[model samples]
Target: MAYLFSGDGGDSDSAVVPLVCLQPFPLLLFASVPVCFILSAALVMMMKVPAFCYWFGCLFCAGMSAEMKAMAMTILYVCCISFLSFSLCIISLLWVFCSVFSAFFLCFFWVLLIVRDCLVFVWGAKIQSETCSLDSP
Candidate 1:
């Protein structure tokens, strides 16, 4: 999560340690966007309700944050609205707007959990490898 990444101890040893590149991790998350989109889109194709669409929209937002470009971010916003529209239709069908909103909040929480764990794993591995390299030399 951005919070964990911005936390105090995260960058403490960076004076001596190397920072990882931004390319591939963002790309990997980018590649996953289509899959999420397709799955949510499929739910729409199947005429399922809005909750699924909302959840997928959150995923799409999380993916877009990985991109550094303003244009890509704009495209992501458009995609989000499309997905939300479908989700809203579903919510209307079931007459459960409150429940759908709660689930949407929970989806965001999980996305944060995923981002935090991934950063911890990646930075921890890098630090371990650097320590090993120094010790071996």
Candidate 2:
């Protein structure tokens, strides 16, 4: 696990750094915060559409024998309910997919940031040691 953060040479000192310290707060903030806002906006937009019940009622209630009208209305009611439920299910699934994708990228961005910091730290230490050695001779 630590090796993932430590650069090429596998330094034990780098491995000693706690995993918790490497967690990047900015990645989580950047990934989830905007997604939450966007999801809320989308939910609001979804809710603003007029309900299908009124439209279905009006369309299915006209011009038929009483028995035929009853039967047709029942079928239309079921169909409209099914279509609305299916659309809701699809929207729910899409929200879940977007959240999961954001989480994945959050972890990815955190790891990249940690690895970058480790590399810079290692390079700076190397430069300092080289300059010290040159001065000693």
Candidate 3:
């Protein structure tokens, strides 16, 4: 039977088994970024601060995750409307410069966050050793 031979056909959807599937830590940590961003946005909104940056970051994480899963078409489908809204702002000349600057800042922050999370994972033992050394010193 096809089911017996293919073992449920789960692999049909995924072109390749993800690196995340191999090492669970990175996947779990990466997936949590969106949740953190969303929660931070909620907190900021509660405190009456602007929450756009946090929301943008959450969207970026979701988009990136979709892209990572070899779903470029899906990402395009979902993010197209948001991208059009941004383009309209640029076209209408409403806070165009500010939008560009904010986009750059968000990109920088995302890079930093990813590096921080990855470094925390990669050099965890080294960080612990250094912290212990500092405390003793």
Off by over 4 Å in 1: 1-95
Each prediction's TM-score versus the true structure? 0.31, 0.54, 0.25
Q: Residue by residue across 1-137, what tens digits does model 3's lDDT show? A: 11111122345422233333334444444565566556545443433423333444545535455335345434543454455455444444534454565557656655665675566567988988889999994
Model 3 accuracy (lDDT, Cα): 0.48
Q: For candidate 3, report its TM-score.
A: 0.25
Q: Which stretches of candidate 3 lie over 4 Å from their true place?
A: 1-94, 125-137
Quote model 2's TM-score: 0.54
Give the per-residue lDDT digits (tens) of candidate 1, residues 1-137: 12224333556532121222213344444465567667666644533332332455645534443343345445555666677676556544444444454456556655765687678889999999999999994
Candidate 3, pairs of clashing residues: none
Error of 1 at 61 (Å): 62
In terms of lDDT, the best-performing candidate is: 2
lDDT of each: 0.52, 0.58, 0.48
What order do candidates take by TM-score, descending?
A: 2, 1, 3
Model 3 alpha-carbon miss at residue 77, Å? 46
Winner on lDDT between 1 and 2 is 2
Model 1 TM-score, 2 decimals? 0.31
Q: Show the lowest summed lDDT stretch of 10 residues, model 2.
A: 47-56
